[model samples]
Target: MIQDLRGANACDADGCDRALTEPQLVFETDAGRREAYECPCGAVTITVARPESSR
Candidate 1:
């Protein structure tokens, strides 16, 4: 598994696991970056935190 240190909530509201695939670019903003993942059950949203120094 990818050891992404960034905090993540890898499941949907129903508490289901996703068959994650290569992330596809969705968009980005000044707060952080966003990527979309394909899933057999549902979708996953991962948010990576900006570096403290960059804040």
Candidate 2:
């Protein structure tokens, strides 16, 4: 099964299991894109994706 991982969220630093704010576009290219999600509790999560053509 193909799961959509982009919907995943970073847990808060307090361990409350709260979702972080929307991710910001940190980088991008013809090959892929990068995003950053920051929690008020100072937790940060970065995600990267590459197009199938880039493989």
> Which residue pairs in candidate 1 collide?
none
lDDT of 1 by residue, 1-55 (tens): 2325123434453767544555655566776566666555655556465535677
Candidate 2 per-residue C-alpha lDDT over 1-55 given as tens digits, one digit per residue, 9 for 90 to 100: 0123334544646665666556754687896877777666767777777877877
Clashing pairs in 2: none
Candidate 2, run of 10 with poorest lDDT: 1-10
Candidate 1, residue 7: Cα displacement in angstroms equals 16
C-alpha lDDT (0 to 100) for residue 19 of candidate 2: 65
Q: What is the lDDT of residue 1 in candidate 2?
A: 7
In model 1, the number of clashes is 0
Q: Residue 24's C-alpha lDDT in candidate 2?
A: 55
